[model samples]
Target: MPVRRDRLRRAGESAFGALLLTRMILMTLLALLMVTGGAWSSWDTARDALRPPQGAAGPLTLAACDRERCTGTFGPSGETVALYQRIGREPGETLEVALRPGTAEVVRTGAPGVLYACLPLAGSLLLAGIVIGGGLRMYRTAWATAGAGIALLATAFALW
Candidate 1:
C-alpha cells in the first residue's frame, strides 16, 4: 500500500511540472508575436508619407480634331496627358478633367494599402496568442499553488 501511494504522488508531481513548463513557453511565444506585428505596422506608415505626384502638366495643347480636347506633357520626365472637356464656357458646354499617371508615384503610397489589408488578420492572430498565453499562465500558477497546499496537507497528515 505504501509503495503504490508513493508512485501515485510522484506521477502527479511530474504532470504538474510539465504543465507549468508548457505554460511558460506559450507566454514567451505570444510576447514575440506582439513585438513583430507592432514593428511591421510602424514601417508601413512611414513609407506612405514621402510619396511624390506623378505626370506633371507643363503647357496645355489644344487638339486639332476637337478644340475642346487638349493634350500636354509635363515635368523633366515628360509625362504624357490627355484631357477631355466635359462642359463648355458658352451655352451648351461641359467641364471635366481626367488625369492619368504616366509614371508610378514616388515613395509608393501602396504600402498602407497592403498593411491595412493584412491588419485584421495580424490583429486577430496577435489577440489569440495573448489570450491563450495569459490564460495558460493563470491556470498553471493556480494549479501549482494548489498542489503545494495539497503536498503540505499530506505531509502534516503523515507526520500525525
Candidate 2:
C-alpha cells in the first residue's frame, strides 16, 4: 500500500512538471508571435518613413483634416494627396514628404514619420515583456524587453 501511494505521488509530481513546461512553451510562442506580427505589419511603412527620400519629393500642403486623416497637395504638380499617417497639423501647414508609388499618400521623411510608423512595434514589445515575465517567470529578460519598448516610445514622442 505504501509503495502504491509513493508511485501515485511521483506520478502527480511529474504531471505537474509537464504541465508547467507546456505552459512555458505556450507563453513563449505567444510572445514570439506578438513580436513578429508587429514587425511584419509595420515593416513597409516604417522602412519607407525611415529611409532617405525617394521617388517624388515635395512640400505637401495640408488642405483639410477630418478626425484622423488629412488631405493635402503634393509638390509642384499640385496633385491632391494625403498624409500617410494621421497628424495634428492644421490646414495650410506644409511638410516635406516622399510619395509612395501606386498610392495617393505621402510619408513624412524625418524623425516624426519614423516614430509614428514604429508605434505598433513598441506596443508589441511591452506586451511580450508581460508574457515573458508573468507567464514564463523570466523577470530580468522581461524587464529588458519592456525597457526597450519604453525607450522607443520615449524617443519617438520626444523627437516628434
Candidate 3:
C-alpha cells in the first residue's frame, strides 16, 4: 500500500512538471506574438495618422458628440460612418476627417490622430501584462509592462 502511494505521488509530480513546462512555452510564444502584433498595429496607425489617404478625405456632418465616440454622415452620397476619435467638436457641425485605410472609421488629423494611434500599442501591452502575470507568474515584469501601458495612455490623453 505504501509503495502504491509513493508511485502515485511521483506520477502527480511528473504531471505537474510537464504542465508547468508547457505553460511556460505557451506564455513565451504568446508574449512574442503580442509584441510583434502590437508594433505592427502601432506603426500602421501612426503612419495613417501622419499621412492619411487622400481618396478618403472629406467633410462629415456630425450628428452626435460624446466623450469617446462621434456619429456622423459623410459624402454627397450620405454614407453613414462612425468616427472613433476624441475630438473636441460639437454636434451639428461639419468637421473634416479622413477615413482610416480600408475602413469607414475616421481619425482626426494632427495631435488627436497621433494620440489615437498609440492606443493599440497600449492595449497590447496591457493584455500581455495580464497574461504574463497570471499565466507565467512573472509578477514584477507584468507590473512594469502594465505601468508602461498606463504611461503611454496618460501621455496620449495629455497630448490629445
Candidates' C-alpha lDDT:
0.42, 0.83, 0.80
Q: Clashes in each model (backbone N, CA, C under 3 Å)?
A: 7, 0, 0
Candidate 1: 10-residue stretch with minimal lDDT:
89-98
* Residue 150 displacement (Å), model 2: 1.9
lDDT of 3 by residue, 1-160 (tens): 4545678898999999999999999998897788678878988767777787867767789998888878899864377777876556688888666777667787666775676787888888888899889889999999999898888888888776
- Which residue segments of model 2 deviate by more than 4 Å? 1-5, 52-54
Sorted on TM-score, best first, the list reads 2, 3, 1
Model 2 lDDT, residue 43, Cα:
79
Question: In candidate 2, which residue pairs get closer than 3 Å at backbone N, Cα or C atoms, i.e. clash?
Answer: none
Off by over 4 Å in 3: 1-12, 35-44, 53-83, 86-88, 91-106
Task: Give candidate 1 regions above 4 Å deviation.
Answer: 1-5, 47-133, 136-160
Pairing residues by index, what is the TM-score of model 3?
0.61
Candidate 1: pairs in clash: 86-94, 86-95, 87-93, 87-94, 87-95, 88-93, 88-94
Best model number under lDDT: 2
Q: Which digits, one per residue and each the tens of the lDDT, describe model 1 over residues 1-160?
A: 4545688898999999999888778766665565466556644433342232343322323322244543444234444444433222233222122233442221212333233323333454445444454655555544443454355434433332
Ten contiguous residues minimizing lDDT sum, candidate 3: 1-10
- Against the hidden reference, what TM-scores do the models get? 0.33, 0.86, 0.61
